[model samples]
Target: MTGGPSRGARGGRAWREGHAAEWIAALWLMLKGYRILGFRLKSRAGEIDILARRGRVLAVVEVKRRKTMQAALAALTPHQTARLVAAAQQVVRGRKALQALEIRLDLVALAPGRFPRHRRGVGA
Candidate 1:
């Protein structure tokens, strides 16, 4: 067998990387004045990586970490995007206070040795 980590080990490392990426994204959002409302929230639609709010903007954030920024950005597929939006809507539906806020699908793309790139209003 060639020299490489086992499948389980690779999977575990990916999970750890994802978890750390989420934390980094959260901190980046908080520093930008967004209040984190939820982290890894599991709703009827899907699992939302992060839910944040700043003024009237409610951001449904998806955190992605890969070797490159392009890879990170490409990680969020259309189906996943729809799920994220649905999850955000569910959160809004459950809270009357969030009814008036604008729901924005945001992306926090992370790569090694680089600052997180937070893109807002990515629904379109």
Candidate 2:
């Protein structure tokens, strides 16, 4: 059997798709009353896809572009989870007002042309 797309070709497509997904998700969040605080926030620990807020609620969201929920969930490796938690803590520590606000971890899994599957209040 012949190899399909080369590694570079596949990677380029995936990168483009991921950016598209992020833009779509960001727009969706804006429409849903969430104020976008940061996009692609990174620390030594890890990167947070999106950080948005609704009132006093601080949300750490992971945006996944996947064909299925299983595929999306699979992307959240244990190491990533740890880093997400650490980054969230760092965010909270920096702002006293935000620190008192209830923190929520969420997942937004996007499948092409479909409603994003949002899982809210995820814990470590």
The candidate scoring highest on lDDT is 1
lDDT of 2 by residue, 1-124 (tens): 3679988899999999988888788888888899888888877667788998998888898888888766875676666667888998887787776788777888778876578777777654
lDDT of each: 0.92, 0.81
| Top model number, TM-score | 1
Assess candidate 2 and give its TM-score to the true structure: 0.83
Cα error, residue 57 of model 2, in Å, equals 0.7
TM-score of each: 0.92, 0.83
Please write out the lDDT profile of model 1 over residues 1-124, one tens digit for every residue: 8689999999999899889999999999999999999899988999889999999999999999999998998888899889889998898899999999999999999999999999987776
Clashes of 1: 0
Q: How many clashes does each candidate structure show, in the order listed? A: 0, 0
